[model samples]
Target: MRYLMFRLAHISDPHLGPLPEATAWQLANKRIFGYVNWRRNRKGVLTTDTLDNLITDMQEQHPDHLAVTGDLVNLALPAEIANAKRWLTTLGSPEDVSVIPGNHDAYVPNARMKAEEAWRPFMSGDIAHSGPLTFPYLRVREKVAIIGVNSARATLPLLATGYFRKSQAKKLAKLLDECKEKGLFRVVMIHHPPLKRSTHWHKRLIGGSRFRKTLAKHGAELVLHGHTHLLTKDSTEGPNGRIPVICVPSASQGFGNSHKPAARFNLFDIDGEAGNWSCRLIERGYSSEDKLISELGNQMLSIPNG
Candidate 1:
């Protein structure tokens, strides 16, 4: 049997904006907070020119697939959702892209429903079965399986937490098992980190414990997420071994202090067999001073041939 190398470009938290035109009624709710933040501080930290440069750079790399872990829209406004859909078209065809929603994508209770409808093509599985979109959506790209989980949900004002529903949790384990049997490189992508302490208290994933349990039970090659908006590396247990969970900074983060790094994305060059994988991670980010996007970090991750 021959193994082929697969390159996946992972990006998160684009939070695309300029806050599309919306009615006052739309801004009367939770969106008000998001809109105010966007106008006051976020707008400065996140610039369209910076984001465009980052995307252009990623396109230059031309990975086999692009896995975006959500927050395409900040307020989940109807217009914002529409804007994100158009943005998705630019990312690539549904077959070349997979996406999951973030807390901002479901800023309001009903906003999640609207988001599902708008991003259905990108989140739906290859099998194509369903009236409504469902989580643990597995997109098989040749030698890789990109499984997207929906951690985005509506919450009270000031809360940015995500939730992995009991139902989604159950399906996630089974999805991992199926992927394992196929011997494909499984990359679990979500908006929130599945590990505890990976985020602020108010922004953590609600069912992280259960999510962790599922992963330890079934296992996956790698996990990618983006809710924290910073580059972080950590790991948790897996059935056969340890699973690497990486979080990259906002793809639109222009520049900032230690807390806020500039726009960045993760590129994984993967190959080899189960338990003996040779994966090279290249962390790429924008350089405002140089007006270019360049490699920021690199690591050789090997799954010891145990």
Candidate 2:
């Protein structure tokens, strides 16, 4: 029997707006200032045109599933979330896409406590909470399993910390075990990195070390995240094998700087019977008329790690 295969497009940290005035001011004073310096030195470019090009390219690729890791909004405002929902709708049906919340998504003081109430309309599966952690939820497909977790919550400005909560971690273990028994290719998604080194001190996932341990035990095939706004990759040795953790760059990085203008997204293809997988990075550029264009990069990875 020839098992089914699927193509998945992974993108993260779009940071849509309704950007708050305070945040906008910070970006202008700090990020924009740096951006101007870089541009003056002919180092980078910042523009929304990159995002437009990315969207157009993704539409053409037409992956079987789209996984948006997080930070769809800059300020966690209702208007911003609504705008993000509209963007997702334009991509495809809600069923074809899966999303999770980032720290910015939980703008209100108790946003984590009320995530389901605030963002349930955009999500497509059961999301009832079990204690403080509501996760290990499943998005089942004919060829793969998408497991999502909630790692975003309001934090003190000084701390800027994120947590998965103990209950959620334990639930994730059980979900992974079950999925493994069923022989499903599991793709775990979260806004925060499961490994500590993937983030810095102030912005780290508070329980990341423990989360990594859980994933190592359960054996996730691929782990996807955002939050750092830069392209990065790491791997962890797990009971089943080595699991690749891929971090995507910010889609809006071009907004403040023109020098570092390479904005990109990822495309993944998985074949079940052959146990083969391929991924490529697609970047956005512009034409002389200022129209957006996509430039495809070399294959990032081919699975079975030959």
Best by TM-score: 1
Best model per lDDT = 1
Can you write out model 2's per-residue Cα lDDT over 63-114, one digit (the tens) per residue? 8888888777654545565667677777677678888878867755654445
Each model's lDDT comes to 0.86, 0.66
Over the stretch 173-242, how does candidate 1's per-residue lDDT look in tens digits? 8888897888778889989988878878999999899888898888888899998888888888887788
How does each model score on TM-score?
0.96, 0.79
lDDT for residue 299 in candidate 1, whole number 0-100 = 91
Question: How close to the true structure is residue 267 of candidate 2, measured as C-alpha lDDT?
Answer: 69
